[model samples]
Target: MKDIEVNELKERLDNNEEFVFIDVREEYEYEDDNLGAWNIPLAQLPYKLKELESHIDEEIVIHCRTGARSGNAKQFLENKGFKKVRNVLGGIVAYRNLEEEE
Candidate 1:
């Protein structure tokens, strides 16, 4: 699977590009901080797959506190036939670090 850097993801969001930015962390972790992502915890991903049916073929960027959960999520989506799935390397921690550097 492909991986996206934090800066690239930020640029896409800044440009208002259409893509699915999924937060795979639990609710509390998400409440701590998130990059303007859709609330879809990893636990609920299977049940919520239908909700994202339309985006199956779209660019999907999955993230969590670390990259672990999102990595699993990305694999799951790929197994289910998602065309373009990616994990944001190092997850939000990396993203936050990038933001701090800028």
Candidate 2:
């Protein structure tokens, strides 16, 4: 699976690039903080697959609190035939850290 760093993602967001950003963390975590991604927890992904059908060929980035869950989510989406799925390396924690540094 492909992996994207926090900085690159931030650049993409800043550029207003069109892509599907998914937060695979739980609802509470999402409520606490997020990068404006769609809330689709990893556990609920299978059931929500249909909702993402239109985005199968689109650029999809998945992230959680850490990289592990999003890595698994990347594999799962690939198994389900998603064409352009990527995991955010180091996930939201890394993203927040990068933002702080900036």
Candidate 3:
């Protein structure tokens, strides 16, 4: 695992950079607030692998409420032969703080 700080993640979004951004938080959590990322809860990730097969070799960024879940997601994808998986450091908490700072 490689990790991306929330600030860098923010920059990527601002620039409209192309990458697979997956929100591993629950639907309810995502419904509350999110980065408009494709929602795939952490527990459901195994079942969603086929849909993500196309992005196996692409850069995949995962984030959760904090960082733990997304860190697990990063490792899970990596173990599944999906390289370039990055966990958002400090996750959405830090991301939200970035907006507060602005």
Name the candidate, 2 or 3, with the larger lDDT value. Answer: 3
Which pairs in model 2 have colliding backbones?
Answer: none
lDDT of 2 by residue, 1-102 (tens): 468999999999999999999999999999999999999999999999899999999999999998899999999999999989999999999999999999
Error of 1 at 42 (Å): 0.6
**Candidate 1: C-alpha lDDT:** 0.90
lDDT of 3 by residue, 9-80 (tens): 999999999999999999999999999899999999999999999999899999999999999999999999
Better model by TM-score: candidate 2 vs candidate 3: 3
Each prediction's TM-score against the native? Answer: 0.94, 0.96, 0.97
Which stretches in model 2 have alpha-carbon errors above 4 Å?
none
Q: What C-alpha lDDT, on a 0 to 100 scale, does residue 5 get in candidate 2?
A: 91
Model 1, 35-84: lDDT tens digits are 78998999899999888898977899999887999999999999999979
Alpha-carbon lDDT of model 3: 0.94
Q: Report the candidate with higher TM-score, 1 versus 2.
A: 2
- lDDT (C-alpha) at residue 80 in model 1: 94
Clash count list over all predictions: 0, 0, 0
Pairs in steric clash, model 1? none
True-structure Cα RMSD, model 2:
0.8
Candidate number achieving the greatest TM-score relative to the actual structure: 3
